[model samples]
Target: MSETENKITFEEFRKVELKVGRILSAENLPGYKKILRIIVDLGGEEREIMSGLAKHYQPEEIVNKNVIVCTNLEPRKFGDQVSDGMILAASNDNGRPILLTVVEDTNPGSQIT
Candidate 1:
Protein backbone atom coordinates (compact mmCIF):
# COMPACT_ATOMS: atom_id res chain seq x y z
CA MET A 1 0.00 0.00 0.00
CA SER A 2 1.10 3.54 -0.69
CA GLU A 3 1.50 6.04 2.10
CA THR A 4 0.16 9.58 2.09
CA GLU A 5 2.32 12.19 0.43
CA ASN A 6 4.77 14.04 2.62
CA LYS A 7 5.35 17.57 1.45
CA ILE A 8 8.86 18.84 1.97
CA THR A 9 10.36 22.27 2.37
CA PHE A 10 12.13 24.04 -0.49
CA GLU A 11 15.45 23.43 1.18
CA GLU A 12 14.76 19.76 1.29
CA PHE A 13 13.51 19.70 -2.28
CA ARG A 14 16.60 21.52 -3.54
CA LYS A 15 18.84 18.67 -2.47
CA VAL A 16 17.61 16.46 -5.27
CA GLU A 17 19.56 17.03 -8.45
CA LEU A 18 17.07 16.43 -11.22
CA LYS A 19 18.50 16.93 -14.65
CA VAL A 20 17.39 16.54 -18.22
CA GLY A 21 19.17 14.12 -20.53
CA ARG A 22 18.73 12.94 -24.05
CA ILE A 23 18.81 9.28 -24.83
CA LEU A 24 21.83 8.70 -27.02
CA SER A 25 21.36 5.01 -27.50
CA ALA A 26 19.46 2.03 -26.15
CA GLU A 27 20.06 -1.66 -26.59
CA ASN A 28 18.86 -4.88 -25.06
CA LEU A 29 21.43 -6.30 -22.73
CA PRO A 30 21.86 -9.93 -23.47
CA GLY A 31 21.38 -12.37 -20.54
CA TYR A 32 19.17 -9.95 -18.61
CA LYS A 33 15.58 -10.96 -18.07
CA LYS A 34 14.16 -7.56 -19.08
CA ILE A 35 16.43 -4.53 -19.07
CA LEU A 36 17.65 -1.99 -21.61
CA ARG A 37 21.12 -0.57 -21.47
CA ILE A 38 20.72 3.12 -22.26
CA ILE A 39 23.18 5.92 -22.79
CA VAL A 40 21.88 9.38 -21.96
CA ASP A 41 23.69 12.55 -22.91
CA LEU A 42 23.65 15.23 -20.27
CA GLY A 43 24.82 18.00 -22.53
CA GLY A 44 28.19 16.71 -23.73
CA GLU A 45 28.75 14.04 -21.11
CA GLU A 46 27.19 10.65 -21.56
CA ARG A 47 25.97 8.43 -18.73
CA GLU A 48 24.63 4.90 -18.68
CA ILE A 49 21.55 3.53 -16.91
CA MET A 50 19.92 0.13 -16.96
CA SER A 51 16.18 0.55 -17.31
CA GLY A 52 13.58 -2.15 -17.01
CA LEU A 53 11.61 -0.53 -19.82
CA ALA A 54 12.28 -3.11 -22.50
CA LYS A 55 8.83 -4.52 -21.96
CA HIS A 56 7.28 -1.25 -23.10
CA TYR A 57 9.76 0.22 -25.55
CA GLN A 58 12.05 -1.19 -28.20
CA PRO A 59 15.69 -0.33 -27.69
CA GLU A 60 15.98 1.89 -30.74
CA GLU A 61 12.64 3.60 -30.33
CA ILE A 62 13.61 5.80 -27.39
CA VAL A 63 16.76 7.17 -28.93
CA ASN A 64 16.92 10.98 -28.86
CA LYS A 65 14.07 11.21 -26.38
CA ASN A 66 14.80 13.67 -23.59
CA VAL A 67 14.22 12.32 -20.10
CA ILE A 68 14.44 13.40 -16.50
CA VAL A 69 17.08 11.71 -14.38
CA CYS A 70 17.96 11.73 -10.71
CA THR A 71 21.59 12.56 -11.26
CA ASN A 72 22.73 12.96 -7.67
CA LEU A 73 22.09 9.38 -6.66
CA GLU A 74 24.94 7.03 -5.95
CA PRO A 75 26.25 5.09 -8.93
CA ARG A 76 25.21 1.49 -9.30
CA LYS A 77 26.78 -1.23 -11.43
CA PHE A 78 24.45 -3.53 -13.29
CA GLY A 79 26.20 -6.08 -15.42
CA ASP A 80 28.75 -4.38 -17.69
CA GLN A 81 26.94 -1.04 -17.43
CA VAL A 82 27.70 1.33 -14.62
CA SER A 83 24.41 3.10 -13.98
CA ASP A 84 25.13 6.66 -13.00
CA GLY A 85 21.58 7.96 -12.83
CA MET A 86 17.99 6.85 -12.84
CA ILE A 87 15.61 7.39 -15.75
CA LEU A 88 12.25 8.66 -14.50
CA ALA A 89 9.18 6.92 -15.80
CA ALA A 90 5.61 6.26 -14.73
CA SER A 91 3.60 3.07 -14.48
CA ASN A 92 0.04 2.65 -15.53
CA ASP A 93 -2.66 0.82 -13.63
CA ASN A 94 -1.53 -2.37 -15.24
CA GLY A 95 2.12 -1.43 -14.66
CA ARG A 96 3.03 -0.49 -18.22
CA PRO A 97 6.09 1.72 -18.47
CA ILE A 98 5.80 5.36 -19.49
CA LEU A 99 8.75 7.67 -19.89
CA LEU A 100 8.56 11.00 -18.09
CA THR A 101 9.22 13.32 -21.01
CA VAL A 102 10.04 16.99 -20.93
CA VAL A 103 7.49 19.59 -21.76
CA GLU A 104 8.50 22.58 -23.93
CA ASP A 105 12.21 22.60 -24.90
CA THR A 106 14.21 22.04 -21.78
CA ASN A 107 17.97 21.92 -22.13
CA PRO A 108 19.97 18.92 -21.05
CA GLY A 109 21.00 19.05 -17.37
CA SER A 110 18.39 21.72 -16.68
CA GLN A 111 17.21 22.01 -13.09
CA ILE A 112 13.72 20.60 -12.76
CA THR A 113 12.89 22.16 -9.41
Candidate 2:
Protein backbone atom coordinates (compact mmCIF):
# COMPACT_ATOMS: atom_id res chain seq x y z
CA MET A 1 0.00 0.00 0.00
CA SER A 2 1.06 3.57 -0.61
CA GLU A 3 2.34 5.57 2.34
CA THR A 4 -0.57 7.97 2.15
CA GLU A 5 -2.95 5.05 2.32
CA ASN A 6 -1.58 4.26 5.76
CA LYS A 7 -1.66 7.83 6.94
CA ILE A 8 -3.46 8.79 10.10
CA THR A 9 -5.62 11.80 10.81
CA PHE A 10 -4.03 14.70 12.64
CA GLU A 11 -6.21 14.01 15.64
CA GLU A 12 -5.09 10.40 15.69
CA PHE A 13 -1.46 11.39 15.42
CA ARG A 14 -1.80 13.84 18.26
CA LYS A 15 -2.91 11.05 20.51
CA VAL A 16 0.66 9.86 20.72
CA GLU A 17 2.43 11.85 23.42
CA LEU A 18 6.00 12.17 22.25
CA LYS A 19 8.26 14.05 24.62
CA VAL A 20 11.90 14.55 25.45
CA GLY A 21 13.30 12.60 28.33
CA ARG A 22 16.68 12.46 29.95
CA ILE A 23 18.00 9.04 30.77
CA LEU A 24 18.61 9.02 34.48
CA SER A 25 20.06 5.53 34.50
CA ALA A 26 20.27 2.31 32.54
CA GLU A 27 21.00 -1.23 33.63
CA ASN A 28 20.67 -4.69 32.25
CA LEU A 29 17.55 -6.44 33.45
CA PRO A 30 18.14 -9.65 35.30
CA GLY A 31 17.33 -12.83 33.40
CA TYR A 32 17.16 -10.92 30.10
CA LYS A 33 19.98 -10.79 27.61
CA LYS A 34 18.69 -7.99 25.38
CA ILE A 35 16.48 -5.96 27.67
CA LEU A 36 17.59 -3.03 29.73
CA ARG A 37 15.66 -1.23 32.40
CA ILE A 38 15.98 2.50 31.88
CA ILE A 39 14.84 5.22 34.19
CA VAL A 40 14.00 8.47 32.41
CA ASP A 41 13.26 11.88 33.79
CA LEU A 42 10.45 13.58 31.94
CA GLY A 43 10.74 16.95 33.57
CA GLY A 44 9.65 16.31 37.14
CA GLU A 45 8.28 12.84 36.56
CA GLU A 46 10.39 9.74 36.29
CA ARG A 47 9.45 6.68 34.32
CA GLU A 48 10.85 3.22 33.92
CA ILE A 49 11.09 2.16 30.30
CA MET A 50 12.24 -1.22 29.12
CA SER A 51 14.15 -1.33 25.85
CA GLY A 52 15.91 -4.00 23.83
CA LEU A 53 19.10 -2.01 23.27
CA ALA A 54 21.51 -3.99 25.41
CA LYS A 55 22.73 -5.80 22.30
CA HIS A 56 23.61 -2.53 20.60
CA TYR A 57 24.39 -0.15 23.45
CA GLN A 58 26.04 -0.32 26.81
CA PRO A 59 24.21 0.99 29.87
CA GLU A 60 26.88 3.61 30.49
CA GLU A 61 26.71 4.79 26.87
CA ILE A 62 23.05 5.79 27.15
CA VAL A 63 23.11 7.18 30.65
CA ASN A 64 22.54 10.95 30.87
CA LYS A 65 21.52 11.16 27.20
CA ASN A 66 18.43 12.92 25.97
CA VAL A 67 16.05 10.79 23.94
CA ILE A 68 12.63 10.94 22.40
CA VAL A 69 10.04 9.00 24.33
CA CYS A 70 6.46 7.99 23.74
CA THR A 71 5.09 8.71 27.17
CA ASN A 72 1.51 7.63 26.68
CA LEU A 73 1.98 4.13 25.39
CA GLU A 74 0.34 1.44 27.41
CA PRO A 75 2.65 -0.20 29.93
CA ARG A 76 3.98 -3.59 28.99
CA LYS A 77 5.83 -6.25 30.95
CA PHE A 78 9.16 -7.65 29.90
CA GLY A 79 10.00 -10.71 31.94
CA ASP A 80 9.23 -9.43 35.45
CA GLN A 81 9.74 -5.79 34.63
CA VAL A 82 7.02 -3.33 33.62
CA SER A 83 7.80 -0.69 31.03
CA ASP A 84 6.04 2.61 31.50
CA GLY A 85 6.88 4.05 28.07
CA MET A 86 8.83 3.52 24.89
CA ILE A 87 12.14 4.93 23.74
CA LEU A 88 12.15 5.82 20.06
CA ALA A 89 14.83 4.31 17.89
CA ALA A 90 15.65 3.49 14.29
CA SER A 91 16.57 0.07 13.09
CA ASN A 92 19.67 -0.07 10.92
CA ASP A 93 20.30 -2.40 7.99
CA ASN A 94 21.48 -5.00 10.47
CA GLY A 95 18.34 -4.40 12.54
CA ARG A 96 20.30 -2.87 15.37
CA PRO A 97 18.53 -0.24 17.41
CA ILE A 98 19.88 3.27 16.97
CA LEU A 99 18.25 5.42 19.62
CA LEU A 100 16.61 8.69 18.61
CA THR A 101 18.04 11.62 20.52
CA VAL A 102 18.13 15.38 20.28
CA VAL A 103 21.13 17.04 18.67
CA GLU A 104 21.17 19.56 21.49
CA ASP A 105 20.02 19.30 25.05
CA THR A 106 16.34 19.97 25.57
CA ASN A 107 14.23 20.31 28.68
CA PRO A 108 12.72 17.05 29.76
CA GLY A 109 9.05 16.54 28.89
CA SER A 110 9.21 19.02 26.03
CA GLN A 111 6.71 18.13 23.39
CA ILE A 112 8.06 16.72 20.11
CA THR A 113 6.00 19.05 17.96
Candidate 3:
Protein backbone atom coordinates (compact mmCIF):
# COMPACT_ATOMS: atom_id res chain seq x y z
CA MET A 1 0.00 0.00 0.00
CA SER A 2 1.19 3.54 -0.68
CA GLU A 3 1.87 5.93 2.23
CA THR A 4 -1.22 7.91 1.46
CA GLU A 5 -3.31 4.78 1.52
CA ASN A 6 -2.10 3.98 5.02
CA LYS A 7 -2.64 7.47 6.34
CA ILE A 8 -5.81 8.61 8.05
CA THR A 9 -7.56 11.85 7.20
CA PHE A 10 -7.33 14.70 9.71
CA GLU A 11 -11.08 14.55 10.21
CA GLU A 12 -10.91 10.85 10.95
CA PHE A 13 -8.16 11.34 13.49
CA ARG A 14 -10.09 14.07 15.23
CA LYS A 15 -12.83 11.63 16.16
CA VAL A 16 -10.58 9.95 18.69
CA GLU A 17 -11.05 11.38 22.17
CA LEU A 18 -7.58 11.44 23.66
CA LYS A 19 -7.29 12.63 27.24
CA VAL A 20 -4.72 12.72 30.00
CA GLY A 21 -5.41 10.37 32.90
CA ARG A 22 -3.54 9.52 36.03
CA ILE A 23 -3.31 5.89 37.02
CA LEU A 24 -4.71 5.56 40.50
CA SER A 25 -4.18 1.85 40.84
CA ALA A 26 -3.11 -1.16 38.82
CA GLU A 27 -3.51 -4.85 39.46
CA ASN A 28 -3.02 -8.11 37.63
CA LEU A 29 -6.12 -9.49 36.04
CA PRO A 30 -6.99 -13.02 37.03
CA GLY A 31 -5.99 -15.71 34.53
CA TYR A 32 -4.15 -13.19 32.38
CA LYS A 33 -0.41 -12.78 32.53
CA LYS A 34 -0.25 -9.86 30.11
CA ILE A 35 -3.24 -7.83 31.21
CA LEU A 36 -3.59 -5.43 34.10
CA ARG A 37 -6.73 -3.88 35.51
CA ILE A 38 -6.11 -0.22 36.11
CA ILE A 39 -8.18 2.57 37.59
CA VAL A 40 -7.43 5.97 36.10
CA ASP A 41 -8.54 9.35 37.34
CA LEU A 42 -9.86 11.40 34.46
CA GLY A 43 -10.42 14.61 36.36
CA GLY A 44 -13.34 13.78 38.65
CA GLU A 45 -14.32 10.53 37.01
CA GLU A 46 -12.41 7.34 37.56
CA ARG A 47 -12.42 4.80 34.81
CA GLU A 48 -11.39 1.20 34.90
CA ILE A 49 -9.10 0.37 32.01
CA MET A 50 -7.46 -2.86 31.08
CA SER A 51 -3.99 -2.56 29.65
CA GLY A 52 -1.45 -5.06 28.38
CA LEU A 53 1.32 -3.73 30.57
CA ALA A 54 1.91 -6.54 33.05
CA LYS A 55 4.71 -8.01 30.97
CA HIS A 56 6.52 -4.68 30.82
CA TYR A 57 5.60 -3.03 34.10
CA GLN A 58 4.81 -3.97 37.67
CA PRO A 59 1.44 -2.88 38.98
CA GLU A 60 3.10 -0.79 41.66
CA GLU A 61 5.44 0.85 39.19
CA ILE A 62 2.74 2.49 37.10
CA VAL A 63 0.59 3.85 39.89
CA ASN A 64 0.18 7.64 39.84
CA LYS A 65 1.66 7.85 36.35
CA ASN A 66 0.06 10.19 33.88
CA VAL A 67 -0.79 8.54 30.56
CA ILE A 68 -2.68 9.26 27.40
CA VAL A 69 -6.03 7.49 27.20
CA CYS A 70 -8.46 7.05 24.35
CA THR A 71 -11.62 7.68 26.31
CA ASN A 72 -14.20 7.40 23.56
CA LEU A 73 -13.34 3.89 22.40
CA GLU A 74 -16.06 1.35 22.88
CA PRO A 75 -15.62 -0.76 25.99
CA ARG A 76 -13.94 -4.08 25.40
CA LYS A 77 -14.19 -7.23 27.46
CA PHE A 78 -11.18 -9.36 28.23
CA GLY A 79 -12.13 -12.56 30.02
CA ASP A 80 -14.16 -11.24 32.97
CA GLN A 81 -12.90 -7.65 32.96
CA VAL A 82 -14.44 -4.86 30.94
CA SER A 83 -12.13 -2.08 29.88
CA ASP A 84 -13.77 1.31 29.76
CA GLY A 85 -11.00 3.09 27.87
CA MET A 86 -7.64 2.42 26.28
CA ILE A 87 -4.23 3.45 27.51
CA LEU A 88 -1.96 4.56 24.69
CA ALA A 89 1.44 2.99 24.27
CA ALA A 90 4.08 2.29 21.66
CA SER A 91 6.18 -0.76 20.90
CA ASN A 92 9.91 -0.63 21.18
CA ASP A 93 12.43 -2.31 18.87
CA ASN A 94 12.00 -5.38 21.04
CA GLY A 95 8.22 -5.12 20.78
CA ARG A 96 7.79 -4.36 24.45
CA PRO A 97 4.98 -1.97 25.34
CA ILE A 98 6.14 1.50 26.32
CA LEU A 99 3.40 3.67 27.73
CA LEU A 100 2.81 7.14 26.33
CA THR A 101 3.11 9.70 29.11
CA VAL A 102 3.11 13.43 29.55
CA VAL A 103 6.47 15.10 30.17
CA GLU A 104 5.14 17.67 32.61
CA ASP A 105 2.32 17.65 35.12
CA THR A 106 -0.95 17.95 33.28
CA ASN A 107 -4.44 17.96 34.70
CA PRO A 108 -6.39 14.78 34.34
CA GLY A 109 -8.95 14.80 31.50
CA SER A 110 -7.00 17.43 29.59
CA GLN A 111 -7.29 17.03 25.84
CA ILE A 112 -4.20 15.56 24.23
CA THR A 113 -4.33 17.84 21.22
| Candidate 3 pairs with clashing backbones | none
The C-alpha RMSD of each candidate to the native structure, in angstroms, is 2.0, 1.2, 1.0
State the weakest 10-residue window (summed lDDT) of model 2. Answer: 97-106
> What do the candidate models score in CA lDDT, each in turn?
0.87, 0.95, 0.95
> Residues 28-88, candidate 1, lDDT per residue (tens digit)?
8787868899999887688889889888899889999999998888998777677788999
The reply for model 3, stretches above 4 Å from the true place, is none
Quote each prediction's TM-score: 0.87, 0.93, 0.94
- Assess the local accuracy of residue 80 in candidate 2 as a C-alpha lDDT between 0 and 100: 77
Q: How well is each residue in 5-30 modelled by candidate 2, as lDDT tens digits?
A: 99999999989999999999999999
**Window of ten residues with lowest summed lDDT in model 3:** 73-82
